[model samples]
Target: MTDSARPRRATLSDVAAAAGVSQATVSKALNGRDDVAAETREIVLAAVAELGYRPTTAPAASSRRTIAVTFDIPASPYILNVLQGVLVAATENRLDLLTRLPPDRAARGQRAVGRDWIAEQRASGAIGVVGLTLSHPDALLDAASEASLPFVMVDPVDATHKRLVSVASSNWAGARTAADYLIGLGHRRIAWIGGPEASDAARDRLYGYRAALDAAGLEIDPAHVVADQFDAAAGARHARAMLGMDLPPTAIMAADDEIAVGVLAAARELGVSVPRDLSVIGFDDTPQAPWTTPPLTTVHQHLDEMGRMAVHTVVAIADGRRPVSRHVELATSLTIRETTAPPPA
Candidate 1:
């Protein structure tokens, strides 16, 4: 294909030729590697821009500096809160940050999408990865080890890998605190609503609730422990089902604010008044927590603090600090709102 008919792709050779430099020099300069003369590097980049060459889109590996942050799940209040912190830290460190979502299971393992995404960035000289999953990608951990790139995890991990830095909140402890607050309110026949059973957060929160109830010598009736997705509708359904039982729970502890809001809807629909008929508590005091019909009482996760900490941890690792020891766990508080009150007689 001629230049015009040649598919419009810009290659290292094309950039080198345009800048009257060697391909090796173009590669080094574009990749931000040392040894290329500063002036030569500038010329190659100028030519690259003049030709409208997008490094990331190139078939060959990138020859530009890039950084990436990824999550197993898509952007949610949880992920984005941390992502905003990652961006601030990455920018402060003068690194370009790219956020990618892992592909569905059909494309895992050999396709190991996370590693591929990071590798593509590596080919362009990306030197850091900020992972928001509670677990880190083993392949990604391996790749970073091989490349000596910085790998910062935003949450806890069961397995350890070199260059694995993490910043996390004490989900278990926070959940316990939340449960304790509800228990202190004299709520004995408390019901626990859980999220996806497989989620680390859900597991921890559930453990917290069980621990407190057990300490109180209370038997946890499995029927009262409902599992649902982290949404208001699911919470509503779970609450409705629980309420329809021969004997319903007095207070409900939802897995999240969304689920708690659903509980509110369920109460209204069932002609049960909150605080008088039912007491509700939610986790993750999202912005909407205060707007729920009765202003949901919830655990105030330090989302901003979490985000700021993740950014700090990732950036510190990128700057060559010993980051593995920096497992900072911010505390959460129970924000008393209108939704929760002493259970009625």
Candidate 2:
């Protein structure tokens, strides 16, 4: 599509002018500043909605040094939080940031992103890329290397590849911490619910769990380890299967919050009381974690920091600076909520 044919993005200034208020007033109203009058806030909001104004706190890009954050799927549930962090960094750095939701064929893998796509990015002044889950494709990397376009991956599916520059949480350490916490609670029979076995994060977390078990002289129960998608449905299915065992686990550590929520559902369905009879722990600590029936005990991954650092790394690469490290792994911590307690007598 031609530039002229594209819809013009409504700015804060546009909203301010339409609302008959100063730009700062519009900003305060949008940000919920207490000083803004309720009537003025409503006017600004109405103008914003009418004008289709989207906030981009960042300064405009001068048609040069634009950074593209590409995703595998447009509606991937986890991108919103990460995008916020990226935008914050983009704003601070005064860089133009845009998201590219590649078509399935263009996004499946690095090799899948065709030569035409690379040419298009180069033509559009996209000098750097921050990829969510898209890993190293030799061809795409080669094209990037030749074009000197810096590339960085956020939470890649496989982070072990030396060629890949990725930002990820300390999955192994977080998993180990969860396992140890369960052991500390006097739970002998602990089950694990993890995502697809192929994922590096999942694998690392699984290994960490096992490492903790080994350290505590507990045998890893094969029946308790289930590999499924990181969703409530998968959690429910796995939890049900585990709960059906004659000697079910007293505690279950799920790899993601969605799965943890699923475990809670299965527990409720099976008449298993959380924490009293069965303790549950999850990772990622996404927003939904705290709202589950009994709340969720989770390992928090600093996703926003990861997003912020991703922009910083990619921008640095674009600026012709060689980073001291190609990969960055942020720390993880445990958030104790309502779902975990000492095992039943």
Give the candidate number with the greatest TM-score: 2
Q: Any runs in candidate 2 off by more than 4 Å, and if so which?
A: 1-64, 73-77, 103-112, 135-139, 159-161
**Per-model lDDT:** 0.72, 0.79
Please list the residue runs of candidate 1 whose C-alpha ends up more than 4 Å from where it truly belongs after superposition.
Answer: 1-66, 72-75, 111-114, 134-136, 156-164, 324-326
Candidate 2, 1-345: lDDT as tens digits: 999999888887898899999998987775546899888877776676466454443223343356778875444445666777888988888777878765354453554254434444543456577777663344555545544567788887654445767788999999999999999989889999998876778889999999999999998789998898867899999999999999999999998888898999999999999989999999988888888889899999988888899999988877668766787999999999999999999
Give the per-residue lDDT of model 1 (tens digit) for 153-235.
Answer: 76644425544566666777777887787788888889988887756677788898889888888888889997768778899
lDDT of 2 at 105: 42
- TM-score on alpha carbons, each prediction: 0.75, 0.77
Clashing pairs in 2: none
lDDT of 2: 0.79
What's the true lDDT of residue 1 in model 2?
A: 100
Best by lDDT: 2
Local error of candidate 1 at 69, Å? 2.2
